[model samples]
Target: MTDTTAGTPAATDGGDPPDGSDFGVGEEGSDDPRIEFRGGKWASTLPLVFFIAWAIFQSGVLGIGDTNGLVVGALVGTTLGMFLVRGDWKAYADTIFEGMTQRVAATAIVAWLWAGMFAQTLQAGGFVEGLIFAADALNVGASTFPAAAFILCGLLATGIGTGYGATVAFVTLVFPAGVLIGANPVLLFAAILSGAVFGDNLAPVSDTTIVSAVTQDADIGGVVASRFKYAIAAAVPAFAAYLIAGSAMAGVSLEGAVALRESANALGLVHLLSMGVVIVTAVVGRHIVEAISWGLVVAVASNLLFGLSSASDIVAFTVTEAGALSGLPVVEVGETAGVGGSLYTGAVGFFPLIVLTLLIVAMAQIMIRGGGFEAIQTFLLDRVATTVRRAELTMVLGTATINGMITINTAAEIAIAPYVARIGEKFNINGYRRANILDANTSALGYIFPWAGGVLVGYQVMVGPDGLGSQYGPEMVVNPIEVVPYVFHGWFLVAIFIIAAITGFGREYIPDRASEEVSRA
Candidate 1:
């Protein structure tokens, strides 16, 4: 393996040096004989095109709506890509397998698994019940609650670095409380989603943030700082929007609303400490996997010590005789260990998504080796991306467009990152600026668009056919489609960056100063 990042250069403050030596290249790697695509750049990109098209058909149009289906599509799509290779058949096979097992993809997959377990454990431990108790104790008016919720949920998402987790948390806990206290259903759900957008764009620990930084060669701290202005530019208006909407909307109570207020428990608040552990550890520079693991440990302990659920129940997985895995191990078809605890379900729920991501990486590697990556870079630099302002705008809109089209925002980000890096470097755009452009829009549009993963994640928590609404009471649920028009922050953030790109409010060039060390992120 050759160190493509071979001669390390010292980084400085202000902006990145105008070092064009590494321009127009993908990640650091030595020349591998099998990597060269026999097909032209266009041919090399066929696999990626097929994969994205398949995702659109499955998740965007036909609405299969299950990630595993997309996983199967990617799996088949990548194997088909092998036919385009011009070299040894064995080399092509090896690259596909190698990409499916890449560190970058695996790292992200592991993080998701851990985060899932942590979120589920918190739920089982009555984290929502604790929040409800606090909400009732605080005596916030039902109408004013949506405005307050926007602020609180934003804080939690920013601290924890997972907007999906925040959306799930607020949907389960505060949402029910709001319904009980007479808040408008659609308006309240919008507020919860707005908070998710706020944190996902600006939080250092966010997966999108990490992806944006590493891919663009920016420090995490600098990336967060550079984007804060854009976030605030959009946030102020969004906050006011929530307040106005909350005031105009009326809260209506449901059957369980009263029961919820009466049954709020204070002991479940211990999970707040679990959340804090994750925040502190992540902020102190620990690996996300390690930080989330610590949080998971603490949450399980809180569940047992606080008596939220039994130890066995917390770790349960059901083995039903008629279930999908009828003949598999302890999961017999007839008898249903109750092994499917929040921890178990949460962790496993992301399995399909993880597999899909790995396959996407395999597709990306195909594009890179096949010269498709280089071809796109050439087009951007020689044509549309002419000026610094135009380049930055292209980065912003490009990210937004891709994220909007792809149901999964992370995959969209990965697909476009190489182009962002190559184009930004052409005009000497700072890594921080590139990262901000990549992430802010990636986070915003994911929730704003109808087909996006973020919006679906929240919807699944609320009124999806299998959602808790059936179990907890249908009256408290809000329709996902109805909530789209009210998602102020996501739309506002997109507008802010578009405006910023044109007006040069937040854009920076490498010549402006030295670049910060990217490793710090």
Candidate 2:
């Protein structure tokens, strides 16, 4: 879940000066060599503009939430932008390669792959059955399921430090359990995403958290500490909203709900220890990849040892002719040939998202190298952000706008980071305050939008061939668009920051205090 890429430079300075001297100033509008475009710097926005339009049309107007379709949109947008480049076409081509190879994109890709495999492994070990058993034993009716799910999912996400991982795990496991117990599917999905938003905003190890702190020259620990107030401010209301909505909303009456409860096995709850292993490892500062690997191993071993699943169930090779591998537990003869398993299916589910992320980053790079960001920064500083309040508001709104366009929140945070730093330093804002403003909007908007990475990852789990919809019924599949309005935590977080920006609720000037040296937590 913590996707901080290797080789990210830590901030060396302690904090920006309160005098608003030369420190962190002119970083945004300074003259620098950039790729020229046919219609001035404004033309650099063509790729991102086209991609955003396609995303809105595909996800909003047409109601198709397919990540692959968005991939096509990005592909077409990037291809079209090449025609507008003024200089050598090779420079544009190289920029595409550069964007695709960025550490931010790679970090997200690696986290998704590892998180996917770990989540599927847990499902294979009967984690969903375990939750169903717990729900039934505790007499948790549909009226309170969303609230309970929100808390549990939030805890897991906070511990693991990856909202994407939490979304994948909860949607794959806890979502079906909530549905079987008669919770409204859309509400439950929204609650899960809300929990992810909470963790992504507050988790010290989160990539967005790292980026926000590093860009603002604040310590990661202090950033996490300072943002706790904002996170809780949003979470309290979100939890209450879920409770109220859970009661008002009705759940689908499934034919076998009673039978599923009756047949639930408590032994499956043993996987809780497997989940605990990952959480503990991650919280202890081990790499997320290592933590998930340990958890996957424990899950697979538990499934085999406890008779929860078979080796073939966890992984299997299907061959038209088994040949020499016929005797192996994972090999079998079938009408078709392919590799199938928790690991394979889990990793394969995110293939489209991986490609989309790369393409989107490429588009963002096009905007960056073509001086599109500089143009926006100049406009905001020169025309709009004249006061401290307006500067803070611009940072909040600007971060939200960019995150809305870029599905990857971390990448969006990276794109808008310099502008945020420049704007905050112009007013001598404290680094922690600036980081909070930067990360809160980045974390919230990423999960709320239909085309967002967090929402799409969870949706992929629901709609896959062997997904929850296939296992249960079509009602189990919550459309990405349907859950948008219900992500109370995301909306609440953004609202809290906007109000804070206007009212100076948590604003701190650099004269109030200087932050400690920045370091990776």
Candidate 3:
């Protein structure tokens, strides 16, 4: 979810100096060292550029939503970029390790793993079935399901402090149920993504929040406090839009809708307490790992104690034939079986995404080391960002552009952070303002694009062998492309920032107020 240590020097992940000094921008009158590229600074962008083209071709053109395929693309792109180095291949190779080891990459991977497990455990406990029972009892039909889903998913993401985790949890547990209830599949999926955007932008403990504050040298509390206006300004309209669109959109007609609702049991709702445990613990400043572990323990206990799910259902080890372990509750002999259960499937589901993240970050590291970032910053500062208004606009557009290119929002934020700081400080912009601008675009664009991490993560839960399609039929699956235009909150947030840039809405200068010292939350 969130890392309290994100602001501290120890959180560098090998990117920054040991003393926590910023990268990308060198000190006054000093030139930052850069790896020479054969074709100059622009050539350093080949890896990311190649990966983006590959992503657009695969996910957008061919309509193949495969995370592993994207991983291959990133790998190939990174390797291709290597041959273009002028000399010293070792430095370029080392940058890959440097990028992969960054705290930003590790933080995202850790969240995905833990969130995956927690979501699967809740699913094992019939959390979706419980929601269906509640919906049926309260008369929440297809016309209202999307709106309700948006609100609920937003709340969960806000509590957990990780939009990726919320996306996984809701897509695993909520998406199918919404489709089964006859909600428009594409719209429902978009609603989930929109909710993620809201939480990712507004949540105090969100990774983007931490990164934005720390990178801008501002207090986390002040950054969160100042951005509330912009978040709510976008959220209110987004919620209304969901309600309006939910009614206008045509839901899928499902033959089993009534039957599924009838079979749903309220007992499954006990998992709410399990989810609450995670939210409360994380909100109270507990480590996200600890919070999710507590949630897992509660979910498993609830499943067994309330008879929602059996021990074997939660985690089972299977063999070809009967064995000594077969006597155990979690062990079995079956025709086709192996180690399979919530824990295994949940954690394994994110493996492709994890690899892709590492590769992309490695590519970003190469760009950073080879002067791609510095070159871009110099051009913007010299040619485009001369005035204060232009500087803020440059920051907004620049952040959006980087996020558009990178799938992982936090990594994108980290890569663009130094530029945001330098550009904003050049004009004496408030640290809070800079952090907000840096994070809003990072949070919004990360979920809006078809190949974005938030969108891909949710898409992965829909089409796999163990996904919603297998459980509720193929009609329940929502393609990532179809949901692109409907992530209302993300689009709205970005638009709000663009307008804020032009109209000076909520704009603050450094002279308006000085930010407190950055500290670990």
lDDT of 3 at 455: 95
Q: lDDT values of the candidates?
A: 0.72, 0.86, 0.86
> Model 1 residue 355 lDDT?
69
Give the root-mean-square deviation of each candidate in angstroms: 6.8, 5.9, 5.5
Candidate 2 to truth, TM: 0.93
| Over 4 Å off, model 2 | 1-33
Q: Looking at candidate 3, what is the lDDT of residue 246?
A: 90
Which residue pairs of candidate 2 clash? Answer: none
Assess the local accuracy of residue 364 in candidate 3 as a C-alpha lDDT between 0 and 100.
86
- What are the models' TM-scores? 0.80, 0.93, 0.94
Model 3 residue 191 CA deviation (Å) reads 0.8
Q: What is the alpha-carbon lDDT of model 3 when measured against the actual structure?
A: 0.86
Better of 1 and 2 by TM-score: 2
Candidate 3 has its poorest 10 consecutive residues by lDDT at 20-29
